[model samples]
Target: MQNKKNVTLLIIVAALGYFVDIYDLIVFNVVKKQSLQELGFTGDALKANEIFLFNLQMTGMLLGGLLWGIMGDKKGRVSVLFGSIFLYSLANILNAFVTDINQYAIMRFIAGIGLAGELGAGITLVAENMPKEKRGYGTMIIVTFGALGAVVAGMVGKTFGWQTTYIVGGGLGLTLLLMRAGAYESGMYQNLLHNSEIKRGNFFSLFKKWSLFLKYLACILIGLPIWFAIGVLINLSDRFALAHGLIEKIDIADSVMYAYLGLSVGDLASGLLSQYLKSRKKVIFVYLVLSVSLMFVYLFNTNVSVEYYKYMCFGIGFGTGYWALFVTIASEQFGTNIRSTVTNTVPNFVRGAVVPITLSFSSLSKTMGPINAAMWVGLCCLALAFLATLYIKDSFSKDLNYFEID
Candidate 1:
């Protein structure tokens, strides 16, 4: 068993690592318009660039998810955690020096790759270290604190030049690495390391079994609505609000800020709710329903002001707050051998889902307009998410001292 002091330190470091990961992940969204406008994009070109860049970043995350996830199971979670932060921090600082769109796109992609490793590695570490009954609380505290990074991104993006904002985020990430020097690997992983007979970090093994493949797919689908809510409805709130006939211009940064504030609250509440209910599935179901309900309200409601739009952002964010619980379920579903791989890839794949989700929205918006387009795409995602939730087994209180077999 790990010492209480070390476990606590690990959790704190993991939480802060996630904080920086999220800040870099979301800072691009906050500064998208400003950054693009400075590069001479205007009107539709600006929107196009934003989506393109966002997708590029998500693409990087998608690829990075696989790389870092494999590395976590092979190298150690702590290595991936700090390694990812270091890569993204360096990317962010370089991002501040870009003079053209191509340079910006490249940086976003690099940063996305770097951002991919933090949460899964962090959650897996904390989850494995804590006791089964209390592990939810440990993971909950990490995500609840970490989700606030989006709020900080919004504030800093609003107050500083886009370049300065990127620099600040980079600086924060580098500073965070210093605090991580004392972090150690989980006992489960350490044990796995000693058993050379056991195959570890095998990504292809997941696809070899039909049931296991379904389990992996279910974990990925269960999280689709989260990214849709954040990546589409909130990130592009200005477009949706305008389509709904609001004359007042909405700030994307403010929308992201308020939604993340709600997300922070929601994460804390959902985490506590899951612990109290003692069932991860039940909490996920509740939040999914909330997310779907808010999606309807956000899409269909025609009458709204700036304040109402922001409130809707918060409501949607709160509804999607089951993010940490969703990731926890994925971490618990697999064994230690492939646990890090599953944990890391699941959330990033969910984040990566934004690619298809946004692409669909972009295509549909060309004809039906942004509101109805988001409605259709969001419906598809939510329906898939609900089904995925049903498909996956309840994982609360599952013992983590096992291994997947050939």
Candidate 2:
């Protein structure tokens, strides 16, 4: 009974931790226009600044992903949970007070660094500690709860305004810190810590071998479409709406909220479907196809009502809901020594992929227009994701108690 209690507590705390993470991560998107306008950015300036800040934030996550992943492996998962939350929470509190774009971008970068740790550490802990048979359910709960944070962010950003939303996100992270008091470190990680014979947290080791490099690359590639969809298709909903000649401007916040709500449902459904099908690759492939199909529908059907467009956003989000399984596969693919590193970095790399994805979209937009550029980029991302999926081995039932040798 006590054992079950510990597991339950971990899951709850991890879920809330991720909840705050998502809230902070998505809040900026929700409030970008209003906040930037308040800071004197408008028209093309506002759009340019938004993209810059967003890219900077993802850059921070890319760097922080490596930092925290190594720390999680070298220091401990619990350390990451505590340290990451503190950094991000403090950054967010300061974020509420920024007077200029430079300050805003810097704070967001710091917060990105902080947000980088939550999901990887939480998933690592949950995967290591839970019964192998039920780990998928555990991770699904974390992601589903985490994804709902975007929904909450949408509502909170809409209700409280941007500054207050930042304040609330910071407060939630600090509040979640209190719960970490009861959390325990993963035994698998502990075992690795005691065995000094095994080298741990070696980021460069991933590239030392062709096979290992390919596995890591494939893991990262399979997730590019998810970020491309969110960072491009939905994040630029206003621009797309303009391009489509809509009668009404689609509310970015509502589009984000509805899409995330769909994501939550899709994560739950995909997680369950993967369990039922007993094949992570198959489920991911199916969802990737769904995602591509939805992307085409979204790009081609511009004459639809605002309400219908929002529905399409929801469908796209749902189709991209294979994220939990993607991370789970990453965790399961490696040994205990490098699992945290791989698990943490894979998703962040995917998130960071938004930088190039956005850049490519921007360049292509110059030549083909925004909607057509997005269509081309979306197709390329989907194609790469499919190819990557072909190379990834199924890890649905793989054991986690092992090590990556030097």
Candidate 3:
């Protein structure tokens, strides 16, 4: 009974932690126009500054990914859970009072660093603690609940104004810190805690071997389509709507809400399908194909209604909903000594990929126009994701009670 209770507590805390993570991670995008407009940004200035802040936050995640991943493996997952939330919560609260874009950008970068640790550490812990047969469901629950945070951000941003929305996100993170106190470290990590002989948390080790490097690179590549769809297609829904010849304005918040709603459902379905088929690679492949199909549909259909475009946003989001499984695969592929590092870094690297993805999209837009550029970029991401999925070994049923060694 105590064991079950512990599992329940872990799941609850991890889910809520990720919930706050997703909320803080996306709330800025939801409130970008409103918040920036109040701070004196308008027209192209608003759009350009939004991209700048978004890239800055992602840059922080890129750096934080390496920092937290090493800490997770070297210190412990629970430490990351507590430390990341504290830093981000403080940054988020400060974000509420920022008067300038520079202040806002600085706060976001801090918050991004804090946000980078939660999902990866949480997923690593859950993957280690849960039974292998049921681990997919555990991660599915974490991700499904986490995805709804975007929906919550959308609704809350609409109702409370941007400042309060940020405050609420910060408050949620702080609250999760209390709940995190009861969560325990993984036994696998604990076993290695005193083993001074084993080299743990070595980030450079991942790149030193050709095989390990390819595996890590494949794990990162398989996730590119997801961020492209969310970071580019859905976030810029208004521009896409205009390009599609729709006279009515499409709300970016609503697009984010509906797309995340689909993402929640898709996470649940994909996780279950992975369990039933007993294969992560097959499900990812199917979803990548679905994502590609939806991307083309979204791009080629120029005369669609705003309602049709919103549904298309949902489709694209659903198609890219293999996020949890992808992270789970990363965790499963690695050993416990570096499991936290791999799990923690893989998702952030994927999130951080948004920097290059956005930069490429921006450069491509100059020659091909925004819509065509986005379509071309989407194709590239999907192609890479599909090819990478083929290269990664299937990890279902693999025992994880091991360690990475030199």
- Top model number, lDDT: 1
lDDT of model number 3: 0.90
Q: Residues 1-406, candidate 1: write the lDDT tens digits.
A: 4499999999999999988888999999999999888999999899889999999999999999999999999999999988999999999999999999999999999999999999999999999999999999999889888989999999999899999999999999999999999999999999999999999899999999999999999999999999999989999998888888899999999999889889989989999998898898888889888888899898988889999988999999899998889999999999999999999999999999999999999899889999889989998998998999989989889999899997
The 0-to-1 C-alpha lDDT of every candidate, in the order given, reads 0.93, 0.92, 0.90
Task: List candidate 3 segments past 4 Å from native.
Answer: none
lDDT of 2 by residue, 111-205 (tens): 99999999999999999999887899999999998999999999999898789999999999998898899989988988897899998899999
Ranking by lDDT: 1, 2, 3
Which pairs clash inside model 1? none
Kindly report which residue pairs in candidate 3 clash with one another: none
Per-prediction TM-score = 0.99, 0.99, 0.98
Worst 10 residues of 1 by lDDT: 1-10
> Candidate 1 — which residues are off by over 4 angstroms?
none
Runs with alpha carbons beyond 4 Å of true place in candidate 2: none
- Over 130-191, each residue of candidate 3 has an lDDT whose tens digit, in order, gives 88888898999999999999999999998988999999999998987888779899878888
